[model samples]
Target: MPDIIRLLPDNVSNQIAAGEVVQRPSSVVKELLENAIDANAKQIQLMVKEAGRNLIQVVDNGMGMSATDARMSFERHATSKIANTEDIFHIKTKGFRGEALASIAAVSQVELRTKKEEEEVGTQIIIEGGQLISQEVIHIPTGSSFQIKNLFYNVPARRKFLKSNSVEFRHVLDEFHRVALAHEDIQFQLYNNGEELLRLRSGNLLQRISDIFGRKIKNLLIPISEELEWVKLSGFVGKPESAKKTRGEQFLFVNHRFFKSTYFNKAVQDAFEGLIPQRYLPSFFLYIEIDIERIDVNIHPSKTEIKFEDESSIYALLRTAIKKSLGVYHVAPSLDFEQNQDWVFSIPKKDSPIEEPKIKINPAYNPFKENSKPFTKAEKLNVTEFYSSFRNDDITSDLFDAPSANNEENFLRLMNGRWMIEHKGQLWCIDPYRIHQTILYNKYIKSIKNHALSQQLLFPLERPVYDLEKEKLISIQSKLFAQGFDMQIEDDLLTITAIPSDILQEKVLDIIEELLYQLTEHSEEEFSVFFSKSVSKVSAKKRNEFIQSSQIRPIWEEFKNLEMPYLNPLNKKNYEIISIPNFE
Candidate 1:
């Protein structure tokens, strides 16, 4: 037997810490930007090359470090944020854990240049893989510039596992946006591969939001604010009409730190229960200011998830604030039992001749004239012949089970926007929207893989956008084209002349907006799913627009081909079946 356990070397220890702190290139961006914010920088500049794989540089006009402090900054567990254990509870700065710099340096090539405001000269310290290459006094400005290059160079496995440049760039862009939005008073500029991608001027939170989103969204915002003995909540909630089918526009912060909490998000969603359409999430930029001792920001490595001492009270007050804002802005209906009834019942009298309600109908219309080949139920449902008329080979062969020789196949559109299908001897209720989404999702994944063709529009549509949005849209133009959207950036506008053939032309503009928002706010994998769902709703027939059973035929026809016809794209049951109870 031998004693095998030994203390890991400092380099090995830091490399292990890097695994937690520096998950990807964007993680580096988050650390550097937050460090700049903590430095009291009025203007922060970030530049990245090849989506941060080649280089990531952050320069800030903040109070810089001295020659001795510059060298100590790279040492693991050396930090200025905390002195005693009590300081941990009252954490105010972004970079509290001193492991960030050391961890980042262990896996990458880092060069730090810093000079204090009163110092006549600066210090340039270059370190590679936790080993100091050089440290010398140099003439520099009164700030700090951290240049991290060849990220994960010492860790070849992690470098190889990085996503494509486009995808990685998106992650970096998201970090930049989050930091910029969290601190609206500090100007931030982002550059990618030498081109200025984003410039956020210092302003109020609402101004920053409007600038980033590239729209006059002020009209869509309703201010909300409330203060209790323990917590204060204030921010802007988008009007119900401004709610979207996607979930990108929501931003929540605690003491100017961006974090994600579905628990708190549900409070906002519950406030708009009946105001917005089902399955649609409202947009909100909420800020919570509470005692630092009552909340723990160290629950996660990235500090994006926090624990509140009394979340229930916070939730109750937050939901109330949002509901009050909505009602005050008249975005939600208000009931006043004290109002007089005479004005409500009286309509302005018209002097013109009274006109009878006209019945609009098509006299020559017939419901049985479907373009697909039809066979009665007696033929045992010739699925081979039926799918052939669809001209799609992707459809699976899971149409239905063997039908009884009792009833004919029938589709009846129910008043509540569901479908009633009488097949064989059973009746099934179907959610057409979910079925539609499943079909569209399948089709879209295939299209993306196959590089489907686009359908050109008769009229080119131009949407006004800010310069920042144009740059972002142009960057992801190739990805959009792969999904069959031909988008171009003209002066101050995003122009589209074509879209996916399966998409509805009437909603081309809205679909484009959702696509851009989702791509900007989510990862590539999530954007695909969200894009499909958003388009499915806008393209599918509205619940109130059903004229006959024929409109539902397309959804039914596509749903029958699903590998699991019982479930929708989200894996939820789209239909319910009930057997008849015999009365003997």
Candidate 2:
């Protein structure tokens, strides 16, 4: 018991370090990619199988290692990037602690093949669970190739904590994007399970961004460049219109190394305060280049967090730089008196007298008249006839069938964006939006479970989306078809030959966009739940606008018959009751 504080074994220490460096397959991807960059690789290829559960491979045409160096690279604290304690302050390379390879090898089966450019042959080494299995000279190219198989194999608990393939792959894609973006001149290729996910050729930053995200991002980006005494900031900020509900596209890099800093992100958000909607985050790819001594990047094992000596100054500068760029690009409104010549319209001279506006009115029009044309049919119909007509018309009659014809006194009345009704001698104030969301949620869920009715469009609608979004849509194409969306992909454009009968033609693009956003934001959610929420969100917005119309009564009818009329799909209370006795 007194000697319990003894030093841990090398393998145990390496495995503990692995917890920080190799959190998941994506973490391994980030470390290997950075190592390749540090080696001055011009071309890097990343290959993964089963979202990196089975295998992860990285081949880079970099300055390969020597036979002796290759064997020592997997040892704890073995590094060439730093020599002394003072070297950490001036560090520029990505991996310096030397724990990356050691930590990675501790948790998985790692294979390494490396050869110096001047060498004729390479050295191949295989290690399993931090134990060297074999090392031999082999005839390979003058570069380095690393294969990590059975990741977290020795740590069953860690392996069990991994997410689904789609989610894990998304994280891997995020890491790949960060590395490929920071170094635009380096060619990068990524393949998932033998299918090519991305192939980014050597190009400029803008081109790299466009290739990774979609070509549409090119137009959405607004260039930002500024140089100050403490920090030099440069990169792109997306337009306010391009802001998204998710934070997947936001990136911040310090000296070509990707990092996450909520403080810096807040600066960007503050600059776009009124430009974007609340709860929405704008996309940004900002790179801050400061003196290596001014920032500390070794604070975290992943190196994604940096501590700046002058964070306040950097924040102010970053905010001003982005704000200036937005104004310069005309993305933010300007109050300059100088008008755009293209938008100028000549006003008619006062000499040419202005014509008086004409107005038309029906003097006999009385909205409250009982026998009026609009009110005659509505007033004459009883509850039974009114609901029967909805059923005959194939509307949501089944959802709203009345319990009894004598209970017609429980009528629906629209007031201030809510539905006021009398039920069980109590006044109920219902949020029509939430109630409609519940109705559509169940309806769409049922439609998705069965085959939804598709309304063929007279003219097909073509919408242009990003390449990644196109892939996402393709992955869920069968589910979309089941939900009454007949979509066809041609190039980057998605054509809609048909849509759900209840969806408006004008809102198809908006609906699809929201659907894809929800899907991307919640990839781990069950498909049925995701689809229902997406449909409900889109349909809710439209229903909110529709609740003001004269046709709201039928919608309220359906709301009343819901199995859970008091709560929405999100579990939010939809209505509150005002007891008649309490009111009296």
Candidate 3:
């Protein structure tokens, strides 16, 4: 029998690797920007066309590569960061695995031009489908420039899955922001299809934050700094009052590399407990510094997820650090001042007599008690016998089996906005109030249980996924896979033929997409867990808003009324039938 396995072609290998590194336009942006940052680039210019669907060019004033290095850079597993196993733990620089360039080149037509500062001549190299097409020595500035065109072109399956231009562009913008925020001292400029997006000059962290997120963030950030035995925490947390309903602003970094940590985020959230509203999530940009051996960065190919040797110790330290900062200053701003200005309470005038009050509420009764039953079988029999009275009348033949009259006088609105049939011989009424509540409750409960189905197109359905996301996708891929998802992966493109369990719902997809962006940009934290908590927070908030008192009428009181018949709908006119004649 022939061997079942054989070595794959170079292009296939590159495409598979690209699946690990370049999930979307944002993935390419992250890899290239990291390369620039690692090169110690002082100034970088980024230009994108069609939200990075068509072109992504990065020009950096950093140490350029030689003719030989430029050509070899497109090979898989190629790296200048590590040569031996021991060096993995004691790592400092970013972009270590060297799969980023090779993966990116696999999916796109790439062009590179560079010259070292000391070298008078530069080198130019071009590649398509992981195949080198040209290499030549040329004269250029003492920097490197890379232009990636027709991303995922070789993989039509991936290209076919791309999202709308606006959506893909937003992903590109997100990547640009993260890289720019991490290295605030580096000059970075972003342009979309020749239109200038952001030009960030070297500045302080706060300055960078303000430029990217807007000046509103300036007032919310409070400096946080603490040094423990080995680990150091330094950054800013948004004031509790400024917390947002959305999770777009939270960021956590480790030694300048962006990361997400649920444990650490909980520490931050715990510190803000009681300071912010229950449903609100506080924003922060925190970074921790620890010794290299203390944490492992080489766990994944992308090196975004790190495992700590002593997690509990780190958690305790982070909690204490955040709480200590909160103790020193008021984090929740005083909104009472504004409320006071806009709203003034006036004391009721003593001379004004109160209008006639509502009739005294009936005493409550328990359903378990034998006599407290709202309806008895006898009442239903009586109603049926009464119908016979109308059946004998030839002149009122239409009245015998006619639909129950919906008259307002005979019906009373239940606290839940439902109408009870109020029939007191010769009178009929309906209550619309109760009708609304019943409809709403049924709808809400059904929605929560997944009875409702909604479909949304996966934007950029054929988009590439980065290494950071490859693990995430793989982790959740099973859940999606079980739901009839047709997951096909090629160089840079991941096409989802089916969406799993309605993850494509507008709300669900938005959060998932945000989580993907967060995971890609910040590689240090456990975002999935953090996001699960966020999902809980958001779900709880939605439930509260959906079922709040304003959304429905009070039902508990009406549910327990004295002297009610089992078959008669509870209403004002049923007093005689239940022996509560003084109900008026």
Candidate 4:
């Protein structure tokens, strides 16, 4: 009763540690890749099956360990990187806590094969459920290969919590990207279910980034490099136009280790304050190098969070560096006071004299006469009729005129591109664009729901998009087809053969592009919300085109027919009213 709390068993403690270190397949991928890097691997290959739930294998050409050292590597807190407590702060390698392998082995079936460069033979070891199965001497290559299978097999609860393969694969890809980005010189390859996903060769930072994201990113990157007393920053920031609505491409690395820091992220984002649209995050790959003593990497088990000695200074420096790079690359505006040679004008010779001015005038023009002659009979009749038409007309006459029984003409007046209507001594100013958007939004929603008519195009349109975008489009192809879009995908180009009748032929491409952008922005939103937003955006774009009064009458009629004409689809006020006092 006195000693209720006692030491937990090694297996139990190891499994508990696995909860933090090996959260998912991605966590396993990260730990294994870091271990490979720490081993001074020049080339590494990662093979995964079923998003690492079934199998995860890593083969690296690095310095392998001896048999005794290999056996001891899986012991809890057994590490060669750190000697004592003093080594925690001054850390250089990726793995120092030494809990990664122990924890991973506790929940997965592990197999290890290693051979030192100086050894003539290698050792093959297999373990399951945190217990070593067998160790045998075998002849193998001078490196290490680790195979982890049945991840979380011993922990059924953890296995059950894993997400779908697509989601889990995305996380795995994220981890692979972080590790591959931090070490550009190491050759890395990734394969899923026997299909190659990424094959990165040894290159510089920029080349590595371009290889991973796509070669098109090369032109969009702005180089940033700054060396200071406290910190050194280097890498690239994307141009403002290349900014994305999602926060997927942003990365920050410290001392060759990938980490996340909201403080540092905000600093970089501040540099693009006015350059990018609101809520859009810019793609950046920034690397920060500082003294090990100035940072505590052990603050988090994942080692993604670090406490800096002078965060404020680092933030200021990072922001300034990124801003300077943007200015240098002409991605951001800069003032240049230096004169341009092409803009200079040559001075006239001293011998040349200025020319005298000459003037011409019509001296016979009359001050007050109609063409210097009396008015004709027809002109007199026109003038008399024009004056008679205004006899009973006043500023308030038309304002008070009600619509006729025919309803062909509208009483709404167009002033400065806005519609104004007067009723009961009060004037209402309406935004025609907003009202039209609401009307079209409702119309399109109904059309989509009812499978409205689609106008087949005489000439199909083809648009080129990236691989990721093509995948996204394919995922929602059925929904698009249901919405009156007859589209076909051929490689990276999307060909449109038909579109909704209401959407103009010329605006089809623009509407599709807007839809894709919205898809990227609201990927996590429900399908209903996504569909509504896509239709609304397309309708908004069409409403911006110039419309004649005749065309506006029909749109205004539709708007009036809406149940909520005072508000747009987004619930924003579409018009405002003001009382104008009549003074006699």
Which candidate tops lDDT?
2
C-alpha TM-scores of all predictions? 0.75, 0.81, 0.61, 0.73
**Per-residue alpha-carbon lDDT of model 2 for 1-584, expressed as tens digits?**
46566788999999999999899999999999998998999999999999999999999999999999999999999999999999998999998998999999999999999999999999999999999999999998878999999999999999999977876887888899889989999999999999987899998999998888778778889999998776789999999988876556788999999999999999999999899988789989999999999999889888888999989999999888888887777887643423545587769997998889899999999887788355565566775586666655454333333456778534454546666666677787777778878888988788777766899999999866655566578778998887788989875578999999877788787778777677663466677778787778766754347533345666777876775466787788888987666555
Residue pair clashes in candidate 2: none
* lDDT of candidates 1 onward, in order: 0.82, 0.84, 0.67, 0.82
Question: Please, what are the lDDT tens digits per residue for candidate 1 over residues 172-274?
Answer: 8778878988999999988989998678899898888877776567878899888889889999998887787555578899999999999999999999998
Per-residue lDDT of candidate 3, residues 18-127 (tens digit)? 88788888888888888888888999999999878889999999998887777778888888778888888788888788799999999999999998988889999999
Task: Encode model 4's per-residue lDDT on 243-349: one tens digit a residue.
Answer: 76545678999999999999899999999989997777898999999999999999888999999999999999999888887776667764332243446776879
The window of 10 residues in a row where model 2 has the poorest summed lDDT is 393-402
- Winner on TM-score between 1 and 2 is 2
Model 1: pairs clashing at backbone N, Cα or C within 3 Å: none
**Residue 179 accuracy (lDDT) in model 2:** 93
* Deviation in Å, model 3, residue 337 alpha carbon: 27
Write the number of the candidate with greater lDDT, choosing between 2 and 3: 2
Better by lDDT, candidate 4 or 3: 4
